[model samples]
Target: MDVSNAFLHGHLEGQVFYQQPTSFIDSAHPDHLTFRSTLSDASLFVYRQGSTTAYLLLYVDDIILTASTADLLRQLTDRLRAEFALKDLGPLHYFLGIEVVRRADGFFLHQRNYAHELLDRAGMLNCKPAATPVDTEAKLSTTDGTLASDASSYRSIVGALQYLTLTRPELQYHSAGVPPYARLT
Candidate 1:
């Protein structure tokens, strides 16, 4: 469980100005009105108390959190609720096409959905599944006059393969043409 608007809950000092709400535009002080924008994606604020720590993952309006203490998490949740309207999504699930499965042994993260989506986007969804991405016996070369017509698509496939490495660590060696850790063997 995590606080829903944890970023907005912070005490903001100094004067900030923003356009008035569309419905409640004040005619008198419209020039001096303000609103607070959420924190940026690359920045995050964390709080720790004793053995527990709360992480505030801020990506615009969306937030994800993990805390050691349940009571502290609830307290943070209530505080955030009082300050701003928030939607609490209980437990972690799918995020960015990555499926997170929690089990008694450990957690498993997979990008099967993401892989399927990438295949669809690249128009390879209906194509037959190849036995391997690359053949170890054959060396690929661009100098053979096989210029890539769609460089962007090639790049996209490369990016997808890079993402796959997050869970499929073994793919790294194969992508780099290192046969030692190839997925085949």
Candidate 2:
């Protein structure tokens, strides 16, 4: 779900003042009820009461909500709509570069489009696919390979891959090897 002017939904505490942006105006709106977040991830908020349970994932102004039941989902959406301007984006297909494919038994999530864009940006879309992205047995060293002529491009790709780790955790192991080479540039 997309929140319209989501930033405007925050409640300012105490005396908060800042130079307004171009054509900005002070407006007030009630924020959502307090939801508990786990220690592992602050962005994921869980709301549970009696037999009803709902999970709310907050990423910047975007929100992804799911419930234990269809009725609960409607109730949750209605409650949120009462407090904030929410535009339901319909079924979840893509968010934050990750694509979600809903199946009869489960949801399949992948970053194929994101990874494709990353490779396309890196000019390696035609590169052959390997069994593994990195050689797990190989030792890594910054000075092993020649310095990257385009260090900025290399850094940008590395950063994008770091975000990709959200789904492709296996890349994280090989990830460390790339950063060390960044300094070599």
Best by lDDT: 2
Measured by TM-score, the strongest candidate is 2
Q: Write the per-residue lDDT of candidate 1 for residues 12-35, one digit (tens) a residue.
A: 799888764534656785743222
Question: Which 10-residue window of candidate 1 scores lowest in summed lDDT?
Answer: 176-185
Q: What is the lDDT of residue 142 in candidate 2?
A: 78
Q: In model 2, which regions exceed 4 Å deviation?
A: 7-32, 130-153, 172-185
Shift in Å, residue 174, candidate 2: 8.5
Give TM-scores for every candidate, taking all chains together and pairing residue i with residue i: 0.54, 0.67
**What is the lDDT for 180 in model 2?**
21
lDDT of each: 0.63, 0.77
lDDT of 2: 0.77
> Candidate 1 at residue 10, lDDT?
66
